[model samples]
Target: MHLYFLMIFFAALPAWFLSTLEGWITVDCTRAAVSSPMECTVGERFAFSSRNTRYATWKARSASLHRHDRRGSSVSYQLVLSTASGEVPVLRSSTGSDKIERIARDLNAAIGAGSTRFSAEAPPDSLFWFASFLVFLFAGVGALIALVGKRSGKS
Candidate 1:
């Protein structure tokens, strides 16, 4: 019935969210000159100290997302680290066209959060998950209503 279909649809939403969660972008922290390796997320700023004598410490001010298309056949996503001094080439990864675009868009928004100019906003993970949970909860409510209706002999 419609309620059953709704339940299935709602159940799949969280799975979809989980599958798309940061799997598209593969960050390579190995090339970094840092003393200790570190992992980074999209909406965060990371800082680390270099192993080299010079350029002791560095902070990643923002992330620049790029999409390069080669020969109109291949495409790649590159995440460049922006520091106080200049830009540094960092992570290079591949993903689906749609997913890469979404990641780039979100990265830009996170980088532009504090600027005075207008910027697009990406929804926080907490808010997105909460909303997904509500939909799942409502699907259960719908199933209960359907059961009640069936028991009461009303179509």
Candidate 2:
């Protein structure tokens, strides 16, 4: 029983870590801000930190939907901002492309000086997906262990 509990706790660890990344992005004509749990990661606390609060214009760009053929047919969509420096990813979704596109449209429209662009390049989302996979794997293993332990104890 104790081992089962320990495994369950370990499984929840990844989910807890991922939860830290959950936050909101607020964008307006004046500024764009990213707020996450404790603002621990880069670009999490503030999207436009001391560099420049105001942008001349905001352009919305989407990378081609990536179909991970090897990863159980998972498809991911990314939305990014095209800045003078480079493209900054704002949102990533694995559920649907339409929602992300609509969000990009809204964001660009909100900024007033907005444009839309689609690119063949995909945004870097390997880290996010890797973390997500870890969470899933850990949780699944934990559950399996718990189940097996329970059965063995009964036997």
Candidate 3:
């Protein structure tokens, strides 16, 4: 039974990763020339506003793109804005590194700042690695339990 459950869990991982690609955020700089800051709006592609829609504004001079390395050659990118409080992520993506990099370059050009790429190494305890460890741990324990149970039944 546990083996069957493990199979199901493994099959669901791809579906979960794909589901994350559904939403997008748009950064608008048209108003920047009028002394207005750039704005990032989420859920614009869906043409409907829900509670999940997010609105953020920041001066272009203070924002840049950040790329974070993930497990298995995967990369996560985000548009980060530095403010008095701290850096805030206005947009994010786990795929499409080229497209995201292009957008970041264009935005940086508009801001009059050179486009910069910041790559952060993945932490040892990243979610993906941790989850993978847990899965293997459980599988090993389950296999041991089953093996013991079978041996005892044969006695």
Candidate 4:
């Protein structure tokens, strides 16, 4: 009896781990300040004009949030942009947690953001398919084990 359970558990172990593959969680960016959500990826060059500049360019990287003080609830976000010399903080905005999160999400979606301390890298469709295949394979193996166990008992 114990042997049967062990066989089943081992067969399903890979599937169990693969099943944890999660999809991208959608966020509400309705309140974001961007004129429109533009698709972006890391290291991509984007052009935007501020009042003082006519032709300004920036390389998209990622955004991060920070707190003003330990006792303060005020939150701010800074867009870490890459320039010819090095990375620099090009933009900063003070907002609440929810709005800050939305801004981060917008930057990520626009620039194909990478994994950060607070968020994860988006999983590809192939990963989900591979995980599904493993699940089916384990199910078949478990069924075969059940059949063999039954036959041996009958004999």
Candidate 5:
């Protein structure tokens, strides 16, 4: 019975989790749209705040993660950026003139996509599914065992 429960938890718990979770990723590429002081690096994760108001809190407004590539210049940069309160954080967009143009074109495309900015959210907890599965499995097994014992006149 417990084994059955464990299997159920392993299988059914993920469904509950999938239903409950809203999957979203923050991908900020431009800084000028941000309202807060922005922090950035190539291979590092940093916090980006909006410049909306120094004291007043501004919720995470938008974010974008994108790569700008230039064919002739051999220049490309991957950027993740966000903005709030209308501050647009700027990222390095070019190695030279052509690169700049390429970057601009890419940004323009992002704008046309109608989702130029993104909202930042915490990383998804993968273990959420595991935990939920375990909970369901254990509870189901325990309940089944209890039911069987009750029918057999065993407390």
Candidate 6:
């Protein structure tokens, strides 16, 4: 009976983890004063405009939330220039103000305006520990269920 119940409870695990993921970000994001929310990944490429001046993109090489949704909480990307034709590289510059740095500064200002900054932060490992605990709990329950089944059969 208990083992069966344990198996069913596993179904709720996803919801639990999702809540935890949001809460985890909420605490840290608030600390950093970032805007409402933006999906971010460590290595994935992301694009955004700063101070409404220019658009930039950054690649996320690291991620910590453990799961990938259609998007993440917040991410960073470098700037890329596109042309009217939208063909190959119309123009490109890296991390400098001429275009990229100016944009970055504008964005940084807007974000910093309300004590919030647009930056990508990786999730910590506590999330994984919860997952591991859930797995182990179920394994123990399964073993218990088998033990009971064997004993009842003998009786």
Candidate 4 local lDDT, residue 143: 71
Superior by lDDT: candidate 1 or candidate 3:
3
Candidate 2, residue 64: how far the Cα is off, in Å? 3.2
Q: How many clashing residue pairs appear in each of the predictions shown? A: 0, 0, 0, 3, 25, 22
Clash count in backbone of candidate 4? 3
Q: Which scores greater on lDDT, model 3 or model 4? A: 3
Model 6, span 34-122: residue lDDT tens: 43431221121112111112222221111112334678543322433222333222112111112233433443444445544344322
Task: Give Cα distance to truth, residue 94, candidate 5, Å.
Answer: 34
For all predicted structures, in order, the TM-scores are 0.33, 0.40, 0.39, 0.36, 0.28, 0.28
The better-scoring model by lDDT among 2 and 6 is 2
* Model 5 segments more than 4 A misplaced: 1-116, 120-125
lDDT of 4 by residue, 17-37 (tens): 554543232221122234333
Better of 1 and 4 by TM-score: 4
Off by over 4 Å in 6: 1-41, 44-123
C-alpha lDDT (0 to 100) for residue 2 of candidate 2:
62
As for model 2, its CA RMSD to the true structure in angstroms is 10.2
Please provide, for model 3 over 32-144, each residue's C-alpha lDDT reduced to its tens digit, 9 standing for 90 to 100: 34344444433222112221333333432223234555544545555555434555655433433334455555565654542122211112114434445555566566667
Which number leads on lDDT? 2
Looking at candidate 4, what is the lDDT of residue 146? Answer: 75
**Best of the two (1, 5) by TM-score:** 1
TM-score-wise, the better of 1 and 2 is 2
Model 6, position 65: C-alpha lDDT score: 23
